[model samples]
Target: MEARLIPIALTIAGSDSGGGAGIQADLKAFSALGVYGASVITALTAQNTRAVTMVEPASCAMIAAQMQAVFDDLEIRAVKLGMLGDAQAIATVAAGLRGRDVPVVLDPVMVAKSGDRLLPTDALTALRTELLPLATVLTPNLPEAADLLDTAPACDEDRILEQGQALCELGAQAVLMKGGHGRGPECVDLLIRANGVTRLSAPRRATQNTHGTGCTLSAAIAAGLAQGMDLTQAVTRAHAYLQGAIAHADGLGVGSGHGPVHHFHGIWPNG
Candidate 1:
């Protein structure tokens, strides 16, 4: 019998005890998308659908050791970055990724779905300075984009593109400006690269169970990249996958406040 190889993606992020976002969501997305997942937990959050009550960041040494441990043996084809807790953690991750040749999906996860602060306001500068320059894809929602730029969220298409350009100028190889927080019947996501910007829009889904959306999307993209998809191809597939997940989120009946999307919606019948 011949040996079989599997595409593997790495996730460096926090852990949500709620099992909705962070490392749990990332691993689920990877598995759902047919990629093997490895994780390095940077922080641990006491959170559920309703709120984030407490957070504990891992030590810098442990973070570095985990990254080394993963890269040393595993054939990590892509990386999905989520909630890096502090400036030191960001620096540690950036240092670890400085010379890697894998595709990197940086989610810039600043806040939770419940409006709780995940990354401190003081850590934004560190993230922008160290990580953005090395990111293969930077996925930021309206508020996250605004936080990165230290400005107000864009209310229209033109401003959104303008901010997207501003982020590109800041060193993100490509920016996927997410519009989940925008108003209207349709949600727009712009894939802004050096060549041009491609628009991907889908009708706004009316699901209160949209927790961990950003993490899932980026992780799906990493999974696609691990499976050898281009940026546009991966983003397109991830966008559609997220739509399906959100569309069927309410079926799960997970929590009371905001619930989680079904990462296995495609695999399971009627989720």
Candidate 2:
């Protein structure tokens, strides 16, 4: 009898010592979704639910070496990128990923849920020039979208659509403008592609344990893509998965501040 083959996905991001966000959350989402997860650490962060005390970035040589090692051994089907810390790291990652055939999910992670800065100011230019064009899907919250556009956060639906379109113009094959940061009864996420735009809306769940929402969502999308789902199917499933995770987050009493969402909501019984 032939052995079963598992889909593999790679995450090139920073490490979250808190075990809630960054590489930790990405791997959890991948595992929960049945995808084998690989990682290339670009930075190590000392953080928890409360705040990020410190951040130490890995050298560019090490980052490139990790990428080469993983790509050499694993048949990576998709990739999810989180925090790269600076312009040099971004350039290195972009170089490593260039010409690869796998789908790329770019989560422009600039700030932490605890209001800590993750990516520096100067890295924005590098992110735009180097990574955006390589991304199959770019996921950014309202503030992140604004920061990328160098404009104010969109408050109205029209502005949100405008910003989403603008981000699509910026080079990403598609852009997922996350509405989690918006003020609304329903959190509406827009998936803007070349041909059309898809709107995925769901009621905002009342839960403070949503620390790794962005990371988890992007990782789930990568997992879906790794499993061979199209863009709409992947985004829709990822959106639904993240919604359930956020809804069930309170079940796990992880930290005092913003806790992590239940990555294994389907597998684990309710509290």
Candidate 3:
């Protein structure tokens, strides 16, 4: 009898030297979800929990070549996109993904965990015009949603649904507006599509190790999609997985700010 083969996922994002977010986190999530992961680094960042001290965007041609190299050699079923850094990078990625009929989970990563700008303000228009339409799903936190739509709505369930609708109008197939930053005891992530809206709520874990939550969640979802799960199931499983990662966070005191979640928590034995 032959053994089963897992699907493959590609993450086109930045490199985090801290190994908490960006491509590092995405690969962790993919591995945890039983998917083979490949990467096309858009930029390299000198970052830690506290802040991003430096960032270098890979040239548009180089970025595209890396992506081509992956697709040329592997059977990539899904793609997760993060920190594109600039309009050129965004356009380069969008063009590379245009004809590929793969599920794409776009984590509109505009700001870092330390509140530093990752995507340039001038690139937002290009993102909306070129990338959103091609995205299978767009996962944006409160601030990113507001920036994309140009309005900050109250963080209530009703307003979130409205904002999700507005984002859908911008041409995304589905919009997941995260409520982790919303003021509440429960972290509610809302998924809105032409079919309807579903709100997923989980009690907010009291931990500082949330550095890569958004990126991890999006990558997890992409992994699920690659494994043939439906949208709602993918979201549910990803959320549960992230909650567990947060609960088992490693108390790595690397910085005074947020730390990385324990990506290998349940899978590893403590020494």
Candidate 4:
């Protein structure tokens, strides 16, 4: 038999001990979407569904070594970046990825679901100057987008559209303004590229198990891109996948607080 080859997608992020978000979620989503997953963990958090108790960041040398190990061997088609803890980590990641032609989906993960600060205040400057320009698509929730633009969070559709455009003008190739934090019965994600803006809306499923939704969505988008899909097609498929996962979120009965969406929902029965 001929040797099998697979598309590889990379996730550079922190570790969620809870397994619902960060590197764990990214890996799971990558597998479920039929893409090979590689990871470079920037930080590790002692966290569960309720809160993050502690965080430990990796050294710049270690981070660079890991990225080099992967890049030297594997053909990484796309990358999803999340939870860069501080200025130094962000700078290291940016330097490692600066000239790569791979599609980078940057999830400006500043805060955790439990309301813990994942990215430091001083790091925002590095994120904007060093990282944002490297992204093929930037995914930011309302609060993150607001912080990135130094404006109040958008509460309505029009404001969110404006924010997306502003972010695109900040040098990111494209922007996906996530509306999960918006007040609505539907989740509206706006995709703004050079062509135009496309709104992806799905009925919001009521579930506390939405802890990893953002990470999963961005990872899935990267997976699609790795599979050679266009930006709009990848975003559309990612939105559908996320909606399905949210609708079938597992009630694993593991934690007392927010649970997690089933990454393998399509493969497993009754997720």
Candidate 5:
């Protein structure tokens, strides 16, 4: 009898010591979706829900080595990029994954919930020129989109669609414009691809546990893609998973600041 094969997803991102966002969140999301998760840390931050005090980036050589090691062994079906510290790291990641035939989900993680900048301001250009073109799906919140576009993000539906289109024009095969930062009764996420734009809407849940929402959503999407779902199906599953996680995020008692969503909300006890 042949042994069963598991879908593998790789997350190339920074490490959150607090275990809320970045690699920790990505791995949790992958596991919840039944995907085997691998990681290549680009940086390490002394961070918690409250603030990020210090950050130390890994050498480009080390980053490349980690990625090579993973790709050499495991059959990675999807990749997620998150919280790359600088232009050099971004370039390293792009070079490492340039020819890989896998869906790449790029989460433009800029600022932490505690108001600390994750990606340096100087690295924005590298993200645009080097990384954007390589992404299969670019996931950015309203503020992130604004930063990338160097313009005010639209709040209304019309403007949001325009922004989504604009992001797609930046060279990503698809763009998922997250609307949690936008003002509305419902959170509307726009997925723009070559085919068309898709609107995924969910009721806004009043919760402070949104620390790792972006990372988790992107990771979940990667997991879905690794599991052989189409782009639309993957996005839909990810949206549903995020909604449930946010809704069930009541009292984990993690930290004083913005807490983390229940990553394993689907399988947790009494979830």
Candidate 6:
């Protein structure tokens, strides 16, 4: 009997030296979900739970070359995009993924864990114009959605649905506006499509290990899609997986702000 090979998912994002977000978190999520993870680092950040002190972006050509090398050898079933730090990097990644008809989960990571800006103000237009249209699903938090739409909607369920719809008009096939930042007992994630809005509500875990929550969620969804799950099912499973990770966060003392969730909670005891 021959052993089946796990499908691969490519994460084109930045490197978080803290291991809390970006490529590190993405790869961890993919591994936890039983997928082989590959990455093309777009930028490197000197960051931790405290704040991002510095960021060094890779050249656009180098970034594109990395993507080419991976796609040439690996059968990447899905792609999760995180922080493309600049307009050039965004355009480069967008061009590279243009012809690849794989499920692409776009986590518009505009802000860092410490509330510092990751995606530059100038890059927002490039991301919206060049990348969002190519995404299979666009996952943005409330602030990100508001930035994309140029208006702040109330954190209510109805407003979230409306915001999701508005985001869809920006060229995404589907929009998942995360409500974790919203003030509520339930972490409501609104999914808007041509069919209508579907609200996925999970009980909010009272934990500070949320640094990589967005990155992990997007990666998990990409893994699910790589394994052939539909959009709704993928999002559902991703949410559950993230909830578990949040509940079992590693008590790694570092800074005063939020820390990293334990991505390998179920797979590895001490991870």
Tens-digit lDDT track of model 1 for 1-271: 9978999999999999999999999999999999999999999899999999999999999999999999999999999999999999999999999988999999999989999988889999999999999999999999999999999999999999999999999999999999999999999999999999999999998888999999999999999999999999999999999999999898899989899999999888763
Candidate 4 TM-score, true structure as reference = 0.98
TM-score of each: 0.99, 0.99, 0.96, 0.98, 0.98, 0.96
> Which ranges of candidate 2 are over 4 A from the true structure?
none
The models' CA-based lDDT, in order, is 0.95, 0.95, 0.90, 0.93, 0.92, 0.90
On residues 1-271, what C-alpha lDDT tens digit does candidate 4 reach at each position? 9987899999999999999999999999999999999999999999999999999999999999999999999999999999988999999999999888899999999999999999888899999999889999999999999999988999999999999999998889999999999876888999998889999998877778888889999999999999999999999999999888888885455487888888888898871
lDDT score at residue 152, model 1, on the 0-100 scale:
98
- Per-residue alpha-carbon lDDT of model 5 for 1-271, expressed as tens digits? 9989999999999999999999999999999999999999999999988889999999999999999999999999999999999999999999999988899999999999888989878999999999999999999998898889888977788887788788788898999999999876889999998898899999988888888999999999999999999999999999999999888777577898888888987787532
RMSD of 1: 0.8
> Tens-digit lDDT track for model 3 on 67-139?
9899999999999999999998898999999989999999999999999899999999999999999989999
Backbone clashes, each candidate: 0, 0, 0, 0, 0, 0
The parts of candidate 5 lying over 4 Å away from their true place are none
Q: Which ten residues in a row have the lowest lDDT in candidate 6?
A: 248-257
- Alpha carbon deviation, residue 197, candidate 1 (Å): 1.1
Residue 62, candidate 3: Cα error in Å is: 0.5
Q: Give the clash total for candidate 3.
A: 0
User: What lDDT is obtained when candidate 5 is compared to the true structure?
Assistant: 0.92
How much is 87 displaced in model 5, in angstroms? 0.5
For each candidate, C-alpha RMSD in Å?
Answer: 0.8, 0.7, 1.4, 1.0, 1.1, 1.5
Writing each residue's lDDT as its tens digit, candidate 2 over 1-271 gives 9989999999999999999999999999999999999999999999999999999999999999999999999999999999999999999999999999989999999999999999999999999999999999999999999999999999977899899899889899999999999987989999998899899999988888999999999999999999999999999999999999998899999999999999999999977
Q: Tens digits of per-residue lDDT for model 6 on 125-168?
A: 99889988998899999999988888875478888888888778
